[model samples]
Target: MSKPRKPKGRPVSGWLILDKPVDFGSTEAVSKIKWLFNAQKAGHAGTLDPLASGMLPIALGDATKTVPYVMDGRKIYEFTVTWGEERSTDDLEGEVTQSSDARPTEEAIRALLPSYTGVISQVPPQFSAIKIAGERAYDLARDGETVEIPSREVEIFRLTLLKCEADRAWFEVECGKGTYVRSLARDFGRELGCYGHISELRRSFVAPFAEDTMVPLAELAALEKIEDRDERLAALDAFLIDTGEALSGLPHIAITEDQAHRLRMGNPILLRGRNAPVSEADAFATAGGKLVAIGEIGEGEFRPRRVFT
Candidate 1:
């Protein structure tokens, strides 16, 4: 009998904007895509809670290095808050802790939204992934331990009341990093004199990606039904977004081939005149339209902070 070929994973690189479905954790979604692409390395820009569904950008290979940039980008979410009950975890997954009969009117909800806009202080939910002394806050919360998560400053660029019903309200928010939608719901209820928790949460976009680029897991699963393995691999590869695209928000500087080589070797390059940015300003250095490195300009020198090889 002929010997069978080994199923070695491929060395893939790029970002995969996954439309993470409800009930799927961010880690599990990364693992699924990593297995599908047979990528050598993989990570994600940010975490999408299990109860929330939408854009979860997965980075393969070198793309993982640019995760910080993407994670720092603003996020947009559409969430629904069902009033009358507050949960221990701040979402439907937790135990109901309090109840109220109050429901805010559409006019009332709209009035409160302006307050949420601009810079605001938000206390993260106790049942969160935030690490406290090497242990997850959620883990400690589950064990009946009181986890005091301090309030932090987060920017909310915009907040809109989409709908208001007798027992529930829907809202859309555009906010900076570390802003939790669940906390918004809990606080919103308190502001309106009604206890509430998130019933539905969906992230519409995560920085550099939109609905057009999101690939549903169902679509990926369908590719496996293809009889030809080579054709299937080609189809899967088509979904990859170039790693350089993740740095689109940053300023770009085109460098010479020699400069690219030196940057890749962990060396600095000199820039003069308009090419040199203000001191300490980070920018993407590219060569022939391909990313060479992400570096900060200081004293006319582009020092490589993260080099892409």
Candidate 2:
């Protein structure tokens, strides 16, 4: 067996934003990346179905700890919806359960989008990963078992109909975590009196990051062809939180090197500013103004939860 050639692409750490290619699940993309860098720990913030593609931020090494922060951020997707037919999965990947001839007007679609905005209740599809009892809901759904999926509240901060055509519409959605665009498409069709499903989906932004920061698949793939020894390490810290403004907002607590050591040893050094509130989640905890560890909000005190070296 011949040895595989080494890659020449930059050694990436911290974070890498990819324009995820279609036909690959989010896990598959992360797996490929892990192989590329030989990275032991890494994770992706959002889960994109095999049929969908777009900005997927991957965290590397210690950056994996920040995955929860990224996942909790807002997501924006531009999706195309067909107004005539609906599918069981509420997307193009699913089987068409119904077909109708009712066409929707642009004006009507615009009016419907506003109603979905803000906080509203929604029911997840039966064919979803949500667990019911001890079995996965989607598993039961595929097995032809009747599943009682309940509706829950979700916030759609923005859902705008960007453009429309006969029996079709394109929309840009900015929603909070846990929102299912497929469910929205289903609801959209139901309201228009015509069943429909999502035909296309693309995530463009993830609050702090956007498509502009994404590296194109075509380019990343081309780099794979080059020799490995030529690649330079890409510093991962570039993806860290905007620390300047956050630091300024923090109560300026100055501490000496001796105090810094004590803080790292699980000691609570007094915050210099009296009665000053520490940030809810301060990535860097300062004692006497020296960065100690990550801090958490506690009852009238900031506690060092986890320290990132």
Candidate 3:
């Protein structure tokens, strides 16, 4: 018998970059979109907390296969550090755990911003999603269990102090994957001999995805609720990054057809082509108008990294 045709008006493979409104988690946004489109498969580039807003990329269709590449890319965030207060979660949601009578000076904050522009060790907050003892760290913390989260080395490629007052400062940060803005603020406060916590946060960019391309959740929701099919398609296009586009984001490399075929076979795609591959995880590998996969340089050859799954 002939294969049954798929349902008409089904959503094609794409990404949806939603400007997550405050109080909405990234997963919640994905769930809503999945229901709205009746998608069979979906995922997101990164997880955003309910307190944060901006640039949450939801992957749809086969593009969900590329979500890991986007998730591992560098991220940029704009945030405000409010001094004279320390919260249990290192953000606004938690109760005040500490405070200082002293306030931070604009000059002091300006001077310290440069120190964070490079590599640094950050300890994930106790109230985080990290798992410990078979339960989430946050759950353990909520149960009043004392936990010691090990410090992790995370890179802050760029940290710019935008504005500063007596007790508060706005900042722009470009960091590697897994770095937490709240942790940075908490540590900054410690460095200055005062307390600090994140009061506001907006992720402006995640590597290739930027705020300009982000659609507000409210707007997307309104369109979806109204059954505006055309508008929803536009939203998907706005967020989805095809393989070719994603490959261009990384350093370009060319490979022979045999290598390309091998890459598709899930081999350890190595680094070899026009340019030497960057020693970063999730580096792009491509050639001749197609994406091979993202991989690292090995003994010799662009080893198959992430198959075009």
Candidate 4:
């Protein structure tokens, strides 16, 4: 029998809402954060394009378990769509594919907002991370192969026109998962009889994480200068949000230390007391303010699905 190798680095767990700057890739940001924190595990809730800037929720260690909850949450973005030019990628990074002299008026843009709101079918941009036949759409696109990407239903909770000028328009949108702002710009251009592309985009919020809670990459980088390793790690750790905080949108139940121990041991605990939930599809259990397990509540018991160590 072979001995299992111990994982390296600290077992730090929590979320870091990074204010990702333009030109930084999501995977690259995760790598940097992992290096900075020296964590044994790390992952991100969603992918933010290199050209986009905004809140990117990253999970370290056990916090990674909660990433799916955040990824499914709503997202809000403020973007500038430039008129008269549509690009291959539907953004400034791609080559110009079409052009027009028409520009939509503020009234016209506002009138179109209702059409985009609610559930609508949207085709993702060619340079998107969507996979086709097990290959990334972007990779196939880069190889000069255009694939028929299927349109998906995405919900735009809200869309508002902030301002409209001769060549550009600023807008804010609150949307559900899989909604592509780039696609919105592309479709808006096509609808208005004017070619359009995203010139600037910034994500202001991802669900369960406040806009103000984001820490800029530059601020995190500055902590590398601390002389003492412990102090440096401490400073970085201070920015981590609680592991359970990511599950704020889900139902939660607090359990006793004994129950928490049973959950950790992969056993179901019976729900008791008047306030105990009789049934819940999904819920998380916490003990002394710390996450214990995420599970389903049924048959008057909490069945652990994922336990936090």
* Leading candidate by lDDT: 4
Q: Write the per-residue lDDT of candidate 1 for residues 158-227, one digit (tens) a residue.
A: 8988877899988899999999899999999888898899999998888888778999999998998888
Q: Where does model 3 exceed 4 Å of error?
A: 1-11, 225-239, 251-309
Give the per-residue lDDT digits (tens) of candidate 4, residues 152-181: 999999998998799999999999999999
Which regions of candidate 2 deviate over 4 angstroms? 1-13, 230-267, 274-292, 299-301
Model 2, 76-151: lDDT tens per residue? 9999999888898889888888889998888888878778999989988877877899899889989988788888
- How well does candidate 1 score on lDDT at residue 96? 89
List pairs with backbone clashes in candidate 3.
15-240, 268-303, 268-304, 269-302, 269-303, 269-304, 270-301, 270-302, 270-303, 271-302
TM-score of each: 0.94, 0.82, 0.80, 0.98
Candidate 3's error at 160, in angstroms?
A: 1.6
Error of 1 at 67 (Å): 0.2
Candidate 4 weakest lDDT stretch, 10 residues: 102-111
Local accuracy by lDDT, each model:
0.90, 0.73, 0.78, 0.95
For residues 1-309, could you state the per-residue lDDT of candidate 3 as single tens digits?
A: 999987554555666777888998878888887776667677888788889998888877666767766877899999999999999999999999999988888788878877777888889998888888788999999998879888888898989888888878999999998898999999999999899999999998987775677777676566565457777656545545564553446665767677778888877655545556545544555557566666765555555556664
Better of 1 and 4 by lDDT: 4
Task: Tell me how candidate 3 scores on lDDT.
Answer: 0.78
User: How close to the true structure is residue 198 of candidate 3, measured as C-alpha lDDT?
Assistant: 95
Model 1 compared with the native: what TM-score? Answer: 0.94
